[model samples]
Target: MPGLLYLFTLCNLVIGTGAFVLGGVLAPMASALGVSVAAAGQAMTAYALSTAVLAPLVLVLTGRWPRARVLVVSMAVFALGNLICAMADSLPVLLAGRVLMGVGAVFTAVAAGIAVALVEPQRRGRALSLVFIGISMSYVIGLPLGAWLGFRHGWHVPVAVVAGTAALTCGALAMALPRTISAPGASFQGLGDLLRRAEVLWTLSLTLLYFVAIFCVFAYIGPVLQALLPMSTERMSVTLMLFGLSGVVGTVVGGWANDRFGPRRTLTVQLAVLAAMMLLVPLTRGNHALIVLVFVVWGIAGFGMMSPQQSRLAALAPAQAPILLSLNTSMLYIGTALGAAIGGPAALTVGFDRLAWVGVPFALAGWLTLRLGVTKGASWRPA
Candidate 1:
């Protein structure tokens, strides 16, 4: 079981790297595809949107399959998508490849769901959290490394590397897992039942807006940072690595705060901090120290919300945690889609330096909705 869990973790690392690598490599990808940076950025939106729609659908459809089969097949699709992307010569081709990757992106949610069912109930939470380590590590290693490689060798290099990794992960998962391991099939209808509750919708909105806030600036971070303070490729990679490191720190802080103060207060503070950091981006002009400081804090606050948001959903409807968690994942990707969709145009119009500011309204909107949710069912502390 432990070995299986580790495989899932490695699986997520491959998936997360593929999902986020574009953020760091967007500029080069744009040049390679002969599109503006913003257009190249839409590949992110395409990937996210495809995942948003396909994740739940794929999960439910494949619910009856062996976990190992599902994992291997989905990962194979992801690998194929990356290969398509690596060879893409036009924006449409890149977008098509991204959509294919999104189809395979369902692996994360399915893995999470099965992780819940497969583990002994007592250790489920710990096991689930363990699976998520790959996600943060993706940021720490994948994003920056892809950025560095893409910059040096052109965008295709990183995509090709990721494709290779995904292929390897597929084989590893197939070898590591039980042939007959199966969990209850999911129901998209069941997901709809959760959404019927007003509180669930409202709470889910917070997840959407929060991610919308995070990804808007994040999707274009490479260009945004470059516009502010130009740096060599090596320096940019280091800067991105620092940002990723800070996110890991923030995830820890979020867990601590949730334990002591509860998810609500922890998130409230995090959201406010994130919003302020977004606004602070433009003001960091001519100030290297300030930009560095803001990006670090922003990384902390932005990533910190994950722990609480999941906790908040669990607390909202205890019996519904599993599905709510899955649904929240859907909302998250949807938000990612929206953010990337919005960020590109906003970056073009508002200018890259002001890109962070575009996300400010989203953060505050989430903050206010969260506050309002408390009046109905959202609580300050988990009861």
Candidate 2:
């Protein structure tokens, strides 16, 4: 179980790395593929939309398989997707690879479900916290390193690294994870029953809205920064690393808060702070120090919500935990696609100067959703 935990974390790290790799390599990928930067950005949208659309299909198909076997196959596919990405010579081929990677992302929820299954109920939050640190570390180490490599070598080098890493983690998971079948009655069909609950739907809606707000601003952060100040790729990488480092702290604290207090209160605070950060971004335009400071707070408040949200969904529907979690991931990427889609056009129209203005409403709406719909005046213990 411990081995599965570690190996799954590594796989998630690879997923996290792949998620943002294209953002960093946008210019180079665009140049190489003979497409515009906007076209390259579409690869991100393709990856996200594909994940959103394919989640149910993948879950339904793998419903009866041993989770370990499912994980192994998924990781192999993920590696193959990255390999295709590394070797692609045309825009269409690259987008296809992105779609393949999105399909393989089903394993992320599977891994989270497996981790939760292995731990006691009371410890699930802590266990998930440990697992999610891989995501934060990807921001801190994986993203910057990929960007640095992309800047020096080629865009393909970073993706090739992801392929190699995924392959290694696939081997580790195949050996480490037990070849045990899922508990009886844990079927994908149960997802429909769970979603019928108001609380469940509201929780998922909050997840979607939160990411939409976040990615709206996040998708164009590079352009926003470049517009505000002349910065090198190395400088941008380092700045983003600091933001990621803050996220690591936030993830740990958010998990502890969820288990120690409760997800409702924790998430309320996180989302409120996130909304404030979004509002403040427009004011910090010219001052690099202020912008960086806002980003640091944004990192904490933004990424912090994830662990609590996951814990909340699990608590709300433990019977449907796996499917619900998978659905939550689907919602997450759906929001990502929505954000990029909206953000790109809004940025183009209103300019990057006012991008965060559009994001603020979504953040506040997320907080309101939790407060009014999910929590309903519930009290939680303080840490």
Candidate 3:
């Protein structure tokens, strides 16, 4: 189980690296492809859009296959997509490649499904936490490394690194997992049934709201920092690194809290704290040291939300955990896309001074919704 968990962690690292590379390489990619930086940034939108739309559909369509086989194939496809990005000479080609990466990255749901399937029920929260921590690790290791490679060589080099990693991860999964460990495949009707449940729908909505709040500020985090602190780019980079490191701790602590106190109480408290964090965003102005403290707290709240939400969904629909988890991932991406879209306008209008405050209602609303919709130990099996 430990070895298998490590493999899934690596798989998640690959997924995270691919998802984040666009942000780091947007400038170089735009320069190389002869497109505007904003145009190059559209590749991120394309990836998020495709991931949101395709993840569940692809799971249903391929649900019948052996899970390990599906994972291998997905990773292969992801590698292929990154390879395309590495060689792309035009914006359209890059967009197409990003779409492919989105399709392939849905395999992350497979990784989570495998984690839950292999672990004991009591330890499921811990297992899910390990799976999610990989994303934070990407920020800690993969994203920075890729960004550095892009700065040193070219944008293509960073993507090429991801392509290589995906290929290796695919190979590792094939060698590590046994053939007997797979769920029965799903039909479109199966997915439809899962979606019709009130709990599932509402739970997914909460997940969406959580990310929308975070990304609304996160999308404009750079300018927000600049407005408040007026620091050098190096200091800004270091601040972000510290935030990412704290997030790694948050993921672990979130899982432990869920296991100890139950998801409902843990998540409610976390969300409430998250709302408080947003409320503090406006206070960081001109206080560089204070801003650092605030960001650390923000990172803790930011990545901490995943474990409880994931544990909730897995508990609600164990049989459909893979499909449900895939949908959760989609909702998160949709929130990210919407948050970025909303952030642009909010930054322009309210300015970053109050931009952090803009996301406060979202966090509060999510907390309120969770309080109403999810009860302590209140999980319902899919009919």
Pairs in clash, predicted candidate 3: 63-185, 64-185
State TM-scores per candidate: 0.92, 0.93, 0.89
**In candidate 2, what are the lDDT values of residues 196-287, reduced to their tens digit?**
67777778889899889988767666677666665788988888788889888888888888888888788888998898988888888778
Which candidate has the highest TM-score of all? 2
How accurate locally, in lDDT, is each candidate?
0.81, 0.80, 0.78
C-alpha root-mean-square deviation, candidate 3 = 3.1
In angstroms, give how far residue 257 of model 1 lies from its true place.
3.5
Better of 1 and 2 by lDDT: 1
> In candidate 3, how many clashes are counted?
2
In candidate 1 the C-alpha lDDT for residue 300 amounts to: 88
**Which residue runs of candidate 3 sit more than 4 Å off their true CA positions?**
24-40, 151-154, 220-234, 352-354, 375-383
Greater TM-score among 2 and 3 belongs to: 2
lDDT of 3 by residue, 1-383 (tens): 45677777788888888887666555566788897644555676677778899866888788788887888888898899899988988989888998999899878888888788888777888898898888877766766566567756888888988899899988888888788774545455567777776777778888889888887776555557777877553566566667778788888988888888887788878888788888897887888888888878888877887988888888886777877788899999888777766776777688876788888888887887676665432455211
Candidate 1 residue 32 C-alpha distance from true site, Å: 1.5
Cand. 1 TM to true fold: 0.92
Mark the regions of model 1 whose C-alpha exceeds 4 Å error after superposition.
Answer: 1-3, 118-127, 180-183, 315-322, 378-383
Query: Which scores greater on TM-score, model 1 or model 2?
Result: 2
Residues 315-356, candidate 1: write the lDDT tens digits. 555554555666778888889989988998888798988888
Q: Which pairs clash (backbone N, Cα, C closer than 3 Å) in model 1? A: none
